[model samples]
Target chain A: MTQAVATNDRATTFDVAAVRADFPILARNVHKKPLVYLDNAASSQKPRQVIEAVDQYYRRHNANVHRGLHTLSDEATAAYEAAREKVRGFINAAEIAEVIFTKGTTEAINLVAASYGRAHLSAGDEVLITYMEHHSNIVPWQMICEQTGAVLRVCPINERGELLLDAFEKLLSDKTRVVAFNHISNALGTVNPVKKMVKMAHAVGAVTVVDGAQAVPHQRIDVRDLDCDFYAFSGHKMFAPTGIGILYGKRYLLEQMPPYQGGGDMIKTVSFEKTVYNELPSKFEAGTPIIAGAVGLGAAVDYLERVGLDAVSAYEHSLLEYGDQRLKSVPGLRMIGDAVDKTSVFSFVMEGAHPHDIGTILSHTGVAVRTGHHCTEPLMKFFKVPGTVRASLAFYNTREEIDQLVDGLAKVREMLL
Target chain B: MNAAAPDLQDLYRRTIKGQAALFSQRRPPAIVTHRCEGSNPNCGDHLALALHLEDVAIAALGFEGESCLICRASAVMMADTLAGATVAQAHEFSRRLDAFLHDGQPLPGPLATTRCLEGVRAYPSRLSCALLPWQTLTRCIQPDPTYATTHLEAKP
Candidate 1:
């Protein structure tokens, strides 16, 4: 394949079909038509490498770790630990111990809320979150505050769906113990200015926790560089299995927090008298871990590494631009979250039709898109509509898919109007 | 050319015409200014059903929202069928409609007009899209005093 030299901020042009070929599911048909999987923000399609990695783990290294003494056991333990290192490097965490595996971002947030919020927060202390947060990010803080008598405060977002940074700064105070926000909005795809937010939160001695579920898969993340106390993300959104996710905390902070779950693997010793929790990451990871999921995530990371994140980001941005142009051409279509810096998720409402109708019509054409509040109900309420049809793209997606979507939308206009 | 031919079968199919005929003038009591809102949280098909009930029978039923063809058509079918029927009859019709959409069995006799929704049998997820309005109507009639208190409680 001929490679065009990169100039400016754009990626050097490459063979798009070759990239699409790596994902096997993309070849499958839905409703007797080619599958144009655009719901990447919900979950991504797995490459053969990630799928095979999980298969290889079950086929070859099928033994449990930490408790076994045999050779297979040793191999399993080493592979599992290696996956942790992969996760550590993926987000640029300071140490592997700081990267704790959870079921997904939702569980990770709950863990922090139950553990840190229970231990550190008290009455009159405030937990600050933004209006743009997903239900996962918002509810956990609300739960924690409800239990602790701590007040929950919100930083509002402007009409563009961008967080009001000045309002956020104004809300910060000595009583603000924590600031939890999504790094990128799953519904709107607006990439929040998280690093700056984290820095500001730190200035007030408030711990910052980022919901990186949408951010990590699309963009390069440097936890150390971002300097957030805690970050949470799901592996499924990053092309891994659904159950596996990572929660990265600062080393010192992770060490201080209590164990989230009381079960096997999290305890060093459990006696009738008292129990001693395991150190660092193990303390957070309770019960039998998602061994196969970790292996799958490691494989996904390996695949992304080989393709190069910069290349993937550039290709996705091009697809986003193409989608924006194509979708804009459709009459009576209004785009939501038209931020200057955004991810490849498009949230829009047709002028006369509801998002549900638009999504249904699109599905008939074999173009799958998410339509509704996108689990950000409060954000939906803020926008004063039930929901919008979201067509989220990934690196493997092409401009042709966007054209199909636009065409499908036009057909919907023809039928509905 | 022949009045008998056009009268033998209305402009549309017998089923469509029958459904349309059954939908004639039955405005609901209190006009149920607010319709039942139902959403399939998984795939995002949301709809609201407004109704006007007259005693035990439905007087007028209309829907204002959007969804897939199956859903929209189902909404139209639901409003048409339930408009002149009692609450219990509406419930039974919804149950049969649900089964039919799920590819279980066809509705018998004139009520078989629901066959139009068979187009959605292949798309199971869209079944919820189609049934959302009906489900919301059921919620409205289920006799919960709290239903009047919360405007958005029926959403699922």
Candidate 2:
């Protein structure tokens, strides 16, 4: 474990007030109190740079890409492809062709399930996933298994929300076709050991697909270093516009699989007899892509790069540690997932209070959080609780905000109990 | 028998105190015996509601489970409110309580004693929490041989 000194040295320092200035919505008050937005796991607040990028694209170069040979189209195509290159560099992928854009992580996972899973999976083959997976990751494999007669195998997590690595390794066999799991759980905030999981999956001749929706926004991701066959994350989770995401697939696997959608941009030539598909990325990116969303995502990537991922991760880690200790001091309040290697997500249930009631009371104090099963019903069932209140943090969040949240939860305890 | 009973707010104060006193006095059994199980599987709140009925009135009511405070508090409130009320009155009280919580309407004057639940108006999701015990009691007091003798599961 790295000492606090080393971690502190590596951490990036940011002017929170200036950072908050970049996000216009954070300035507004909710319920007559300054909004303390803590639902970053659901979606992050976009900075001014990303907002301006979307606005600029719409105002200046709002033409369709890949079709028009005109100047506007050329600019749009170049800008859109430039966003792709940014993503390629962001994840340190070997080539630009390996990055395919989709609506979001949900679509990316479905693409893999439909294209890759449908083609390669057969009866008696297994799709391995962890219990901590969000419904997006779990349901796709279930649907694929229903279609292909492949069985879905779940690797369980302990009470602490940490994945049982030994159990996961034991579940792998020659029949395993793919292992799809979240890099960080949206509900529990448990950062799974993906690099080790990928290595184990590879040893058993199975490909790994990581749902990076919760990971990409908080930490540095290198797809090449992860050695994963597929990595999917939503732009919205990374402070970009909604309805746009990136899917990083290994070049060989992506080239081998059929295109996810058949449309204008994905085709080489269309005729009555037959139509051939386009090249690597364009083949997967079917229609007129999310131009504004892509530009916004690129701007978000730039903002994160300027802040430095290592710094962002370190700041969040310290916040989580402080939050954990503070929240623990609240009587009858228990955190749901207490994973040692967790990110700054606090999911907890008050001993005598419903999560919804606690969330409502907290909202009155201008603290916004997600309260429910968080789309992990199996995990909730394992814990034997209805749901938990999830307070997720980002780089812009501060220690004072955590103090406010703790104070708010203390008030909730008084009101309810 | 009724003199426009007391102010509803005063009734609520008394009910809260009465419930607190009753919970403190008996410390109701942690595990219910002669149990009738009711569960809202969707939210994972499971309970065993036990009632002692005599002379067409609820002599006592006790419940055991690990549920949200709303449900548990509502259970304690029910035990305090229904102790002397006839089975018919208990059924009527449950309906009015449900309407007040779910529909956001004021409780009728005769049944306004349960108005401490008004706090629940702000927290809509906990409306189910405040009504679970009452719903269980309604079924517990039904006269039909199967409905009375047999426990039933209520789906949310």
Estimate, for each residue in B19-117, the C-alpha lDDT of model 1 and write its tens digit.
Answer: 433322322335674456666665445555567777777777876543444455566677766667998998888788778767558795545656765
Name the candidate that leads on DockQ. Answer: 1
Native-to-model Cα distance after best TM-score fit, residue B122 in candidate 1, in Å: 1.8
lDDT string, candidate 2, A33-137, tens digits:
788999899889999899999999989998999999999999999999999999999999999999999999989999999999999999999999999988889
lDDT of 2 by residue, B40-109 (tens): 4434455567767776876677876655545666777777777778888998888888878767667776
Clash pairs detected, candidate 2:
none
Model 1, A1-417: lDDT tens digits are 333434356547756677678789999876667999988888999998999999999999978878789988888888888999998999999889999999999999999999999999999999999988888998899999999999999999888899988999999999999999999999899999889999999999999999999987788899999999999999999999999999999988888788889988899999999999998888988887999899999998888787778777777777778789889889999888888889899999888676766776677677989877888888887887778899999888877789999999888777656
Tell me the interface RMSD of model 1, in angstroms: 9.6
Pairs clashing in candidate 1?
A357-B67, B26-B59, B26-B60, B27-B59, B27-B60, B28-B52, B28-B53, B28-B60, B29-B52, B29-B53
Which numbered prediction scores highest in TM-score against the true structure? 1
Docking class of 1: incorrect
Off by over 4 Å in 1: A1-11, B1-28, B31-39, B43-76, B143-156
Chain B TM-score by candidate, in order shown: 0.67, 0.67
